[model samples]
Target: MHTSHAHTLEAARYAALAREDHAAGELRPLPNYALSAISACCRAQMAADVPDTTADLIAVLDSYKSPEELLREAEQKARSEQEYEEQQRAATDMDAPNRAKRYRDVGTATQVIPQLGWSRQMVQAVEYADDGRLWLDSNGTARLINRAGVPGRVVASSRIRLLRQAGYLRSENDSEAHLLVTPEARRALYLADLHPEGIHRDDRAAHAARLKVALTRRRGKQNARNEAARLPRMDVWAMRHADDLPATLTQQREVIEEQRRTEEEKATEKVCTDSIEEFAGRIADHLDDGWALNFEQNPYYLDVRYLYLVHTDGRKLRVKGENCGRDEQGAALPAEKLKVWAILPDTDRPIRSDE
Candidate 1:
């Protein structure tokens, strides 16, 4: 063997041993494995001809963390987050009195407008505001009445204040009441028949960049929600067709298949429970009405007796495997093949399906 190759191989061996020792070191209370890992690491570092394996090993040793350590860090992070949220909630709660006081000095309304009518004044005011819901107040300031009794604040006075604040409207009207759509708003909002005027309208290329980005973010969230609503149906469909599953499914089939089986078992258990209840109920009702139990030995199967009840009124409760008599040609009818899935109370009584 070549000398460099021998050195590389020895270094690789020491590196492997170091990793093993490091793992063991974390587990034990004493520092015995830590010393062993350090010794192995030193040997690996000294004998290494090139940097590759040795560098990788050093990186692994420096960065690798145990499952417990990772879990503890996660728990600590979660606790800190919870504490921060609680503090925020507490601060909000404490400030509630002051918050209420802020709104207390607000004035009461003298009269309620039965409904806002689409008169010429209201129409012109809405046009001026560039907002449909807005109407001129007693002072001629454009306002939106959300609450019936409470007075609404000005959305536009000499300018469309609220829309400008929302970035959907801007004023190139400059010292005038009329407002203009922002370039971002022009791209995002579908304003038609309103003022064609806008800030940066001359720059035809700057089409609503900011509003487009905001809309994209909103669409991203909505898309996430859409996938959230859709993806569960895949698991449901997979379980529904579990018996006919193909090998192409990437989800762990062992766990999914086991869950499917468990669900089937539960369904089977419920059926069994229902059958037992039906059986006991029928037997109780029959015995109460003077029906007698006839345990007759089977013809084909040795030592097996069919259990059934007979009534003097020509009504008979037949066991599933009971002989309903031989076929027309007198060949023994296959009694064993009769109605295996049928439960107890195979009655002459009328039911909804019968009706």
Candidate 2:
């Protein structure tokens, strides 16, 4: 009749049902029953009345999740259990083609990789395995490591699946442990000391093939070294002249150089043919502050006869502007370089801020 004891019995009954259904291979309804059982457990701990209430128990039970949350958590646990069971089954399945070839000592599974065409990553994976398994060292830079070994190249985790697809990891893997390589790959890459097991060759021919692979690898490496040694010393005979290189490359160089010369030539001519404004502007630097300039030109020659220095507080000064010479700071500049406004030849104008 007690609510907590009654709910506890209910929980036990539901749990028993779940376990029985799971044993009978009828798992679909287990999470629903599991959720019900957990709800009962939660209610069992809630204070039914003050007499039965303990503050800690009541507070803890108050923290119980809503029904929907409890259901989701049960479903998630079920999924995890299902996955774990599947992995366990796979681990025990001795007849799987991938695992059955585990102990092979020799013979290529198939001609999957091309001759000398193994990528550096693939070769390193095979080369740096520990025992028969490649393990990870948990580090940012030290990825794809072999235990206690020098750091291996950072191969992507996805590359493990590729090795499985290739024949190198063609055997010797536990269900989810894809890093365990086959004996043949281990012997060829690491040990070179395997007498075959149940899967493949068990003789002199296997050892000879392994040696032949090693020899081929060395010869290829030597050939690469020879070519590398010759590379810097050798020059391309076709690229000896501008025309000998590709026309587009020659044109690119010519285009940039031509742009440089075009601007440079204008700058060179600028020294001789400066605008009259630019020539007159220089005189301001030599003039004291508050003093401005104006000019009137000769009728036929490129020269001014009347040039005035006007002060802001109403004062005017005149310098004889005909054929005058100046220093680098525009001191006493000649009249020819200072006059351009012939339209106002008779009028003297103040050089305001707008000028």
Candidate 3:
């Protein structure tokens, strides 16, 4: 007898279901006649003719194997599939991070802007700013000119204004003349290999040089204004002590010298006071031997004062001092009789009198 392909396929499917039932322990202790029918069904699958009905197909499957045999086969097949999956997962875990990093490093504005539906020219214009901001004129023209003295791509103004409306860029000031790139825009530009001001994304030296030049210019302007303000004060001082201006300028010299000395003395005193108190408290809580303040001395003039600390093993450290004296009102008192000194732990040498 011959069977059609569909009938053969159907018989195989019924056999598979019976096998699952056995594996699940729902079918057991198969009868001999059923086992024989199942075997006959398996053989029929190789031939053209096989069972035409589902019942006949299932009856044939029952003849081939007992429930216990079917269950064992199912379990073995499942174990093999699980092992294959675990191997695939382990391989993926090892390669995932490096793959992700490579993906991130390859991003460029040309590639990213297209994804956001923005034109390449817009990104180019934004990248022209050395400071991540673009300034425009009343006519919506960019205020900055390139090295060749040509106007920038002000035609992209419409696109920039649209982007600002969409929240990708923001007005830097009230004039609506300047736009700053928002973080989102900067990130997109970074991914696209488009850096502002023609600067290389990773060129730290070039970036620092530009920053230094800007700061120096600002400082120079500030200094000029300060010198202008001080000119009248200088004239008045010179008039008050014409003789002293040529000889020693003793009063002016003393005022400047005292101001400098007082600042140094206060700083030294603060460091010594904080270290011996606050730092020592935290250290004591953590160490078994701990630390203790040994002694502190106040100086009247020109000699070093001391803050001493003792460790568990009897080692002593002289930590800090102050030289300038202050009256009750915190005014700078005469320093003619006061002395200050300290022995630093790192060098174990007394601080110089002049220092």
Candidate 4:
């Protein structure tokens, strides 16, 4: 048989064997046999052409790899490509302008004297000089007077060049070739002053008076209205003594607080004393000398106290009372009414009243 026909028959036999092996569960070795059969067929085809050789076919067969290995290599190649793309994206992001940093750089540039190692005083001098002109020397170089008002050094050529480039200075060729200070340069030479326009009339006296009234209102002072009537006099005194405003306000607040506290304490004392006296008078009218009145202040109620009226037989009645004239339920009680809540030493439950 011809070599080409023999190769085809051998390939067909191997392919059939590979299929049989796969059916018999020899799956791992099947691909190797199948690839060998394919390689043989390819070589047979190549041999049919005279100039063509089996070298290409042999190389393809020699370079065969398992499916798992080939899949791993493909995944690695994809990961490499993805990583390279990410690196390029990150570099592009880094090259974008940072607005915050650019703003800071602009502020720094605006504050400092640009291009020349001159101090702020020198810049100010140039701004306030008689002519404010930068004259050019015969060599086409700009020159400026020294700090002592003597024509000494040539203006830094680089500084003049940079100023021109930055639009802070322009060359005016009228009458003489001299450098003209642009509006931007004039603005840069501006000296910021607290009293830029002129000194005005002082309003500290009025300010202090307003501050005092504001503080009094904030503290909820009872005499704030009465004190406002004296604001004019207070303003005059505050201006004369200037530094005493805070101290005076503080003293007034302390005095008001002290008076309020003293009034509250006295009111509370009168309420408690009068309630006991009135209850004692009522007891004197109804009961004999053997009856006694015992009482203690209630801890929970701010303006309330507890009273125990002991009878001759030792039966005690408990009374609750408020100095601010209200009951435990916050209902308004008569100023003369002593609230009787419970009676003790009962045969059954103690008699109780909500009033």
On TM-score, the candidate that comes out on top is 3
**Better model by lDDT: candidate 1 vs candidate 4:** 4
Worst 10 contiguous positions by lDDT, candidate 1 = 108-117
For candidate 3, the lDDT comes to: 0.48
Q: Summarize candidate 1's per-residue lDDT along 175-289 as a digit string, tens digits.
A: 4233444443332222111212222221121123223433456667556444322211111221232232222122345669888777655533322223333443445443536
lDDT of 3 by residue, 1-355 (tens): 4454554455566656667767788665434334444555566654644443446656566457778978997899899988876674465432334434434434433333333434456556556553534666566555445566544544455555555655566665545366566655555555445323333333233334334444556667556444322211112221232221121234446879999798657645532333234433443343334456544445542232444656777778654444233334545444332244445443445643233
lDDT for 291 in candidate 3 is 55
Q: Which stretches of candidate 3 lie over 4 Å from their true place?
A: 1-113, 129-133, 145-155, 173-176, 194-270, 274-355
Query: What are the RMSD figures for all models against the true structure?
Result: 22.3, 26.6, 26.5, 31.1
> How many residue pairs in model 3 have overlapping backbones?
30
Model 4 alpha-carbon drift over 4 Å, by segment: 1-264, 270-291, 294-302, 309-339, 344-355
Q: Please state the error at residue 252 of candidate 4 in Å.
A: 10
What are the lDDT scores of the predictions, listed in order?
0.40, 0.47, 0.48, 0.50
Q: Model 2: what TM-score? A: 0.17
Q: What is the TM-score of candidate 3? A: 0.28
Candidate 2 displacement at residue 323 in angstroms: 99
TM-score of each: 0.17, 0.17, 0.28, 0.20
lDDT of 2 by residue, 239-318 (tens): 12212211233455688999877765554332222334454465565567777876544344333234556778877765
- lDDT, ranked from best to worst: 4, 3, 2, 1
Instruction: Give each model's clash number.
Output: 2, 1, 30, 0
TM-score comparison, 3 vs 4, better candidate: 3
Error of 2 at 285 (Å): 99
Better of 1 and 2 by lDDT: 2
In candidate 2, position 318 carries an lDDT of 56
